[model samples]
Target chain A: MEREIRIDPVTRVEGHGKITLHLDKKGDVRDARFHVTELRGFEEFCVGRTVWEMPALTARICGICPVSHILASARAGDAILAVRVPDAAHLLRRLMNLGQLVQSHALSFFYLSAPDLFLGWASDPAKRNVLGLAEARGDLTRKGIRLRAFGQETIERLGGKRIHPAWAVPGGVSRPLGRADRDWIASQVPEALDTIRTTLRLFKETFSTAEECTVLGDFPSLYVGLVTDDGAWEHYGGVLRVVDAKGKPLVDGLDPARYEDVIGEAAEPWSYLKFPFYRPLGYPKGMYRVGPLGRLNVCDRFGTPEADAELEEFRARGSGRSGRVFDYHYARLIEILASLEQMKTVLEDERLLTPRVRAEAGINAEVGVGVHEAPRGTLIHHYWVDPNGVVTAANLIVSTGHNNLAMNRSILEIARRTIKDGAFDEGILNRIEGGIRAFDPCLSCSVHALGRLPLEVEVVGPEGAVVQTLVRD
Target chain B: MDLVIGIGNLLRRDDGIGPRVAEALRVSPSVSACAVCELVPELVLRLRDARRVLFVDADARGTDVRLGRVRDEGSRWGHTLGPEGLLELAARAFGSAPDAWVLSVPGFDFGYGEGLSDRAEGFVPQAVERASRWLSEGQVSADGA
Candidate 1:
């Protein structure tokens, strides 16, 4: 008898999705499919707008990481104008991006994934959440909340709002940083650093050597991220870098605007997200990973002292190559540390307070491309404008889209290893969801949709009869 | 200060009601009103200093404009935190949470668009009025009575 198990609306992630597991008569899992059910059509609606509005409009795509879109879109607009931004403007933008990374990565690790790590996976579905973790470990919960607030506060200070601040403009930022704002931001840095260090220590004590790390999405794949010309870890603006599974450089310093020459997007009817592949390797074979794991894998070293030390320790974990998806949590913590360090460095520099932030210019080119390493991974915003500076077309290669292929592959691999004889146990289901959580994919950012829907999982027998169902309301 | 946060994405039809209500109430000197795209945990910190907090949002499950007290209903691990989660975090992190309420306006047609449905738009005045009354009188009748 052929049986199918489905976990719909995978819980604790940003978007809506489901997993379907296929089993043969022998009760062995044969195949699996991860489906993204929501769609927003951001690309279609963005057409016909003025190029100046791209930064503000695209920022609304996701409330969690709107700053990422705002910065990337602004950079794209800069390309269209062919104007170099002022140094002070660049530092301001980098500060905003680092704030985003801190908040976003904290949300992913502490709020979303920590419950499963603290409470046993088989804990009551209702009790396996942040509130529950708060009851079990109040100190840790408080640290998570405060740490995230530090990031949000930094964003609110610079962008003027925590969710969507259109502060970044074409060729530069809209306003320069005031002394009061700089002082307040500087004061918050030390505590943020302490919080990240504590969280890293806790994580190392808890799950760094757990069995799940070896089993969940632990496989070799190509890694990609942004890197400075000097081979330092970068997030805001830099050339492309690709590395093989064994930490060998495949490509480096490729111009971001010419991404089409090296990358390809493949469409699948079953999912709304597109599979981005390395053009040289072709479709499934070219499947690579992005985000924290990918970013850490591609960078030579973090440019900061503390983050560099942590990176060295992190590298020692995987014998100089941290390719396991499980390491994403650790990488995210290290990045948080690095972001705080970078934030301090930028704030301490007096040049960031210069009055000349934006460059005045009209559109000098027909097409422009902007790229940034968002909290989730690498994000690209490409726009085509008419002579009057109205947008004719737009293509957004979001960070989540870049990891679509790897996510699907990870889901299948985990399902096959965990499920047997069609039992579909709660522990097994949790492990499968953990694989997806490792990437912390944002379905809301990846797929466009409105409202929060309940996640439902169902099992069907050979005759297509409902066998069992799990629903998270 | 009394804080009122309007929560929802303006791009989604009736979901924009919260932000629209906030925009309408921006001139009120007594209320510290802000329009946010969604409810996140950080909101608790922002609202911690307020004497009272009122969250105005669109409710697809509701049929009429309703005002109710916010309570701690536990927290989910996802990014979107509800009114209950916000209150809980405030209580735990700040030692005491402000009195909180939810002003839910019935909404339909939550598709991708910039404007609100006629039904949701019609309830805006009533929602704003109720919020004003709550601010002045320190109490609101249930179910818009």
Candidate 2:
């Protein structure tokens, strides 16, 4: 009898998504899919708006990572203006991006995925959540909250709002960093550093050898990220870098603005998210993973003392590329450490206090493209402006879109490995959801609607009759 | 700390009511008001010490201002959260949560662009007045009378 098992609206991730396993006559799993069911036309709405309003307008794309859009859009605006942004504005922008990484990565690691990693994958669904993690690990949970707050507070200090700050503008920032706010951020750094280092230790000591490391989307695929000219780990601005499973650099220092030269976006009917691949390699064969795992793989060094040592230890365990999606959690912790270390350097720069920030200019170019590494992965924003500086068209390749192909392949691999021959349990289903959690895909980043999180799995018999249903509410 | 938290997006027409009410309430120095796009678990820290917290949000299901006790119903939390969920987290993390209520201000349009629908705008002062009274005097009974 042919059967189909469906997991609708996988929980604990950003926004709505689903997973389906197609079974054959023998009930063996034949195929699988990860579908992103939501879409918002941001590109369409921004068509006739003046280019000057884009940074503030596009920042509304996602509340969690609005700084990513703001920076990318502002850079595109900068290109349109054909003006060089002041040094202080760039420094302040880097600080905000780093802060976002810490907060966002902490949200992924501690709140979302930790419940599965720490409380046992098969634990009671009702108790296996952020609330449960708080009960079981109160001290750790509090630290995670504060650590995230440190990042949010840092952002609030700079831009005056934690969520969607209208700070980063086209030529530069709206205002320079005030001394009082700067001092407050500097004071919070020590505790933030202490919390992240302790988190790394806790993660390594507890779950380094867990079974999740093997089955949770552990596969060899190409890695992609932004890297400095010196091949250091970068977040704000840098050239494109790609490394293969063997840890060899496949592409080095390509202009990220000309991403169309090396990347192709493919669409599958099953999902709204586009599958981005290396144009040179073609289609599915060019599947490359991005985000923390990709960042860790593509960078030669973290350019920080502590994260460098941690990276060395991280590399010694597997292929230097760290292809295992399970390692994203570990990589995020390392990046948080790197971000804090880098923040310290930025805070000490004497030029950081300078008041000269924005570079006033008008539309000097028709087409402009901006690229930056968001917390998720490389984010690109391109804009075409008229002579009067009104936007004619825009294209946004968000960080989450870059990982769509990898996510589909991941869920497919997980379904086959766990759900077999038409026999599956809730724990097995949770394992599949846990696999999706590994990448920490943000559906909200791609499309802005967020539905309720109720994972409903249904099993249909050969005649399309419903045989069974399991729900984790 | 007494908190008046406005949870919604300003870009969505009537959804801006929460922040508008919060913005209106800011004139009173007695309460600390903030507008957040969403309710995250990190907000638990702020809720930890909040003696009274009023969560003002746009209610899509109804057409009038309704003030009610926040039922402990946001149990299955994932990416999205609510006042009930944040309170649940506050209890779990800090052993206590603020005495809280939901001020559901009904709205007509939730589409893109700023400003409230005319009808929703009319309800703003009424919602603000009620929320301020509740936060300051604890006027609502335990049963939300």
Candidate 3:
């Protein structure tokens, strides 16, 4: 009898999804999948809207990372008009993007990922949440909340409100930063640094265990992210590059608008999430990863003093290389530090407070593409406008879409490694979930829906015989 | 103290009902005396403090309720509060319960099109009136009665 295992509506990230595993007669893993239930049709509905409204409208995709959509859409619209945005406008946009990275990553690392790290992977499922972690270690949870609040405050201070800010507009921002905003951000830097250092220490401690290092060590997959010609990671502005597992850049200057040419989307019958593959390599060979792990593998350096030091440590820790999956989690904290450092740099640039912000341009063309590094990964927004500036076509290749292949690969690897110990074992299931969470996918941004952290797990024997099941109701 | 939260999406047509109602209460003399707020889930903890929470959002609560019709919600408040895991864990951990109600706006087209359908928008005032009455008159009983 072949065994089967399933996890439904995995929680703490975004959107709805289920995972299923199939075992052959030999009790060996034969197949696995991550199925996304929600349908993302933001692109389909964007049609007929004026290009000018893209920034504000696209931000509605996800309540968590709307700033990413706002910036990416505005950049794409700027491309259509063929106008250079003012320096202040660009700086303000970068500040907000950095703020997003800090806040979003904090939410993922402290609130979502820490439960498993702190309480142990096999901790009670019911007590494996923020509140549960609070019960176990109140001080840590409080710090996590305070740290997350700082990130949200950054959004509120600059964008005027945290969740969705309509400040970023085409050609530039609607307004420039005021002194009050700068002072507010500056005042928080010390505490933010404290939180960053504390988090770094905590992460280092949590992940230093030999088991963690070897559990998911250096799994190979193609990496993709935005990089400058100098080979530095450029979150706000740069060309998209795809690199193979061997650390060689495979392609450069990949236009955000021409994503269709470089990548392709394939639908899995079991999942609403589309698997995006490198067009040149085809689906199976084209598997690649985006987000923290992929970004760490692709970028040569972070370009900040403290972040540089941390990156060196990360490179040294990954068995003398910087490309391991362990580095992905560790590097996320470093990137959090990098983002804060970058925020300070961009904020201090006096040009950010200048009066000249929005660079108004009459829409001279109908087609445009915008791409930017969202907190989770790279995001591309492409739109085709009509003569009246109304959208005729919209195609969004979100960051999560890019990681579909990598996620599938990860699920299989985890399932295979843990299947020998009994597929239904709680510890194994939790670890598998932990590995997937390393990707930190924003499914809500991809397919629009919200509410509920539902998780389901099932195990079956050979010939599809049921063995065990667990669900977080 | 009583609380009213508007939970509608401003872009999608009828989904705007909650925000509109919250906005009306914020300004209206009738229900302005009570505590009120507009938020999404990230602020769930901030809301857990409320003695009573009346949530207003667009909902497709089966076919019985007419679009925009304001109906007294039943005891299904547990589902909408937080993610299932958090909600379940909080309920088990705290052993404390709060009074709550959900005001569902009968939604016809929640598609990507602009604003709520005319039918939904036209019924906004009635929804507001009902929500306002609940805020003003409902008691925050121990059982959330």
Candidate 4:
């Protein structure tokens, strides 16, 4: 007899997600669903506040990725004032952004997803977390902790605090980095560089499974990201560009204020998160991706030397005329390296430690847009302010919102492949969740729609005994 | 020396009301002089030195109290150890844990939405009042002579 199995309120990962799988009479394949459960009203809340308060208020949306919110908000704030921040300010902001990327990527690899990869996917559920990984590989775990700590320290030194620092303000940072902080950041660069090398080596040695390499590779997606005028991935400030599967630019030199004309969010009754797509393309066709995968596919070259080497290797493995989805997974490590290298470049700059960090901007209430590359993906913050500086309207499109379509497609692909396995097991369902986990969607930042997101699953059974009983949350 | 502990996931809507209130108390005109440590559950070890303790957290009682309204806890409270858990964990690590009472705010929603519900918003002042009273009473007599 076969049934369905369901787990709601999936723990460990931030926010909530539900996993459901249906089994046939012989307990074989049926169907599966990975539905995110949560609704965020950040956009609505942004309606009445002042633009000045947005950088700090919006940053509170997610504790794990506040830097993204901070930098993104600061960028949007800059647009409204029509003031170009100092060069030192731009460099310092980039350094902090890199710090965020390093820490967040390290967390995703070592803390959240590593347990499944390192301890065998089928291992006991109890011992399949960071703690379990530590018990098995204490030295590696220690190194991971130190690496994350160093990244966070870099952020704190530059931004002034670990979680939500008030450093990246509208004009620039609140205060310039003093010599002590700059020297402190400089001293840690060598160790930081070493950690990046060690992490890449660890990923290479411990991971690199044939299944990982082949599973979601070669799939096509419309990729969008920010790149500097010199063709390097830009985290601080750059013109937005969209590239199709063949690595051909579809749109370039996009201004943030005009995003409403390019991007539009659609609602699906089955999920809480909204799926954002290129408005001109319509629903399914409009589906696009943003994040590490999208960023890698969209960029012509990485800015840093070490990252450029990894990017070259990534291109070699892609058999497609353009980049493949396979490159997206590989690019994860390369981007982390890029982030680290970028961190070093910013820390080594002497102008970053100047005494005057904050700049004065005359009050000019107008519409503004801010976009920055978050660890998860590209984030945009758009606001409309009155002459008094009070926010009149706000709209935010987060990285997870951008990746919703791709995630759904990936989940179904994984489900169709494993749902019919003869032995009938939960491994297939877990793998589907694992596949989605690679994207690291931030549901807290995505879920904001009216109405329920419907989910359905069917299970067949010969005698209808207890095999699997699952329900979507 | 006893301890006062506040625990809540600040990101979860009204669940964070406790910490917000505690933060307000940390700077309140009444309790400004007292040194109180705020912590999450994982870092409860910092409370080991206190003899008497006060714990604040959000609670759901099915009905009655308004959202955000702070209650002194009923006689037949069925809730788990609020401050007691921290003390217990501390005792396990060291030797002894302190005694404490939990101040609970009736919660409406702990969803991912922003801003506390009106019910929860209304209880902020009441929570502050209870904390002031508890602080004025102190953990216990300071007499060691």
Give me the runs in candidate 1 sitting further than 4 Å from their true place: A447-473, B8-33, B46-51, B57-68, B71-80, B92-96, B103-133, B136-145
Better of 2 and 3 by TM-score: 2
| Docking model 1 quality class | acceptable
User: Residue A102 lDDT in model 2?
Assistant: 88
Q: List the residue pairs that clash in candidate 1.
A: A40-A448
Report the number of the highest-DockQ candidate. Answer: 2
User: Which has the higher lDDT value, candidate number 2 or candidate number 4?
Assistant: 2
Interface RMSD of each: 2.7, 1.3, 5.7, 8.7
Which segments of model 4 are wrong by more than 4 Å?
A1-5, A20-33, A207-210, A216-218, A320-329, A362-365, A421-423, A449-473, B1-145
Q: What value does the lDDT take at residue A80 in candidate 4?
A: 70
**Root mean square deviation (Cα) for candidate 2:** 5.0
**What digit string (tens of lDDT, one per residue) describes model 2 on residues A57-148?**
99888877899999999999888888989999999999999999989998888898889988988899888888999999988889999999
lDDT of each: 0.84, 0.85, 0.73, 0.68
lDDT of 3 by residue, B1-145 (tens): 5556676556656666667766777444323322122332234444345565566677665332222322333212221333233333333334433455666667677665566777777667777777666666655222123
Q: Quote the positional error of residue A95 for candidate 4 in Å.
A: 1.6
CAPRI-style grade of the A/B interface in model 4: incorrect
Question: Candidates' DockQ values?
Answer: 0.33, 0.62, 0.10, 0.06
Candidate 3, A190-241: lDDT as tens digits: 7887788887987787677666765643467788888777777788888788
